[model samples]
Target: MKVIRAAVDEMWSVMGQMTSAVFRHGLPMTDKIAARTALTNFVLHIHPVRVRRSWIRMSYTLCLGGLSFFLFIVLTVTGLYLMFYYVPSTQHAYQDMRDLQFVVTFGGLIRNMHRWAAHAMVITVWLHMARVFLTGAYKKPREFNWGIGTLLLLITLLLSFTGYLLPWDQLSIWAVTVGTNMAKYAPIAGPYTRYLMLGGTAVGDATLLRFYVMHVVGLPLVGFLLMVVHFWRVRKDGFSGGL
Candidate 1:
């Protein structure tokens, strides 16, 4: 009976540790336990063990960074759904869009969500950067992260620009034409840049294919990698909002 009781106690002890590992929140019985939990738990490690209340105040930070990341997630999901039916060729791109709108179930809704989420992400990332600047969070050791953030913002804009032409509408063609034309004013590299972007002289099948590849694959991968570094830096440097 004593052996069985000992075995049961050991089982319960293992179970308790497992529970603690999974749910590390709430007040611990002691500071040692809290510190250990924060050190050992994956989720807890992502956040600082302690922070000043003002650092996380909604009014000061406005939750813009989180909102922007959330919008990015939404765009990724909806964009994937749209991709199943989308072909990047100029021949089928517009017709695919029309079919998505009129035939595919919830396609229109998904497309609109993707579009609006892209727009909102741009706004939120801009506001987040502005808040960081205004709060003096871009100074000192935090500057590298700030640069990463600026790159993120640029990537967001490029993603939007590249996606603007995928629908193959008249408006998209005109907009891209005007946008690419502006690339020709960059001194030595202007015309070459335009040609590189268009894959030739103008926005045609090659342009559509190039933009589509960048929009759906290349840019997002780079942005995601940057974001991982950004978050890591944020953790290491601590919250600048408190500064």
Candidate 2:
């Protein structure tokens, strides 16, 4: 029992060191260990190393950016749950949606959560951008982050548009037709871009597969990478509240 107690204490000591290395708090500025840990810690990197009082004020930041990220997490979890039962083929997609709504336990709830969360994320991201613009947070050093944010907004819209067709219903079909048609108004590459998106002259199996891959894989990966850089820039630029 004495040996066991000693081992357990040693284990706890190691655990405490691990925790402190990643989450240093109240350490002196001269502490090299804390500074080194801060540089490499993923959690610490998400936030500024030195925080200003105005940065934390609810009235200043308004938490819209945080809410948008939370909604994204919700959509990812619910989307994974949905992907298990959904088949992207035009023949199966609508029927699969029907089964999820009626046959699968709690599937409808999860699907609704995903749908509404997507909508909410769009709203929150827009509001977050608007707030930044209103606060003059997009000037100077933040201009690059603003450009990234604009790309993120376009990505969000494309995600929504691509996902609309997954239901494989008349409404979705007609909606995409109208949307893709508008792309033809672009300059020289407009028609080619529409053709590439459709994968043919019309929406069919190839179009469904292409949209499915993009909605599930391509766009999300790009969006996530952008978000990482976006957060990193926010920390590096010092949150804009100082101005």
Candidate 3:
């Protein structure tokens, strides 16, 4: 009997430990408990534990930055859906676009959503930056954060531009060629820079793969890291509203 009781006690302790690890504070009902729960959560902790009601009002923030982030999420989900049908080779890319348009179920909608959401994100991020500047939120300690936000904006544009070439049509080809030609005016390393961008002297298979890789992997990784830092800084710097 003694041994059985000891085993039961040990079992209960083990279960309790597992439960606490999973649930953190077991759940919170009151304001104080809710605050503690937020404090312990990684996602929730990104937002402050408290906020002034006036500071968070919709009129003050307009939520442009949040909407921009929401658009990015939409783009990512839709982009992933489109990727299974896309091939980055010049020979197959146009055919792949047609397959996405007519062959795959819901592919047209997904592709359109990705394209539109990308456009919306560009506008939204621009407005978000404008709001920050108009509010004088970029002064002093926030200046570095502002620079990071600027980099994120540029990344957003580059991601959109790189994606534009993946359709591999005459229009896309001409557009990228014209866009890259501007690099040739940069002096000494200009031609080399264009070569690096095109992966050759002209936009062809190498350029397609380069843009696809940057669109799907490189740019997104860098943009995501900067976005993480931007959000962290926003939380650290505190909202400038109600000032």
- Best candidate (score: lDDT): 1
Name the lDDT value of residue 28 in candidate 2.
49
User: TM-score of model 3 relative to the true fold?
Assistant: 0.88
Candidate 2 clashing pairs, residues 3+ apart or interchain: none
TM-score per candidate: 0.84, 0.84, 0.88
Tens digits of per-residue lDDT for model 3, 117-202: 99999999999999988988899779989999999999999999999999898889999999999999998999999999999999
Q: Please provide, for model 1 over 1-243, each residue's C-alpha lDDT reduced to its tens digit, 9 standing for 90 to 100.
A: 999999999999999999877776557788777887787787667777777898899989899998998898999999999999999998899999999999999999999999999999999999999999899899998989999999999999999999999999999999999999999999999999999999999899999999999999999999999998999999888787664
Ranking by lDDT: 1, 3, 2
The number of residue pairs in model 3 that clash at the backbone is 0
**Tens-digit lDDT track for model 2 on 80-126?**
99999999998899999999999998999999998999999899999
- Give stretches of model 2 more than 4 Å off: 1-41
The local distance difference test score of each candidate is 0.92, 0.88, 0.91
Given candidate 3, what's the lDDT at residue 77?
Answer: 89
The regions of model 1 sitting more than 4 angstroms off are 1-45
Residue 216's C-alpha lDDT in candidate 1? Answer: 93
lDDT of 2 at 207: 88
| Candidate no. 2 TM-score | 0.84
**Runs off by more than 4 Å, candidate 3:** 1-29
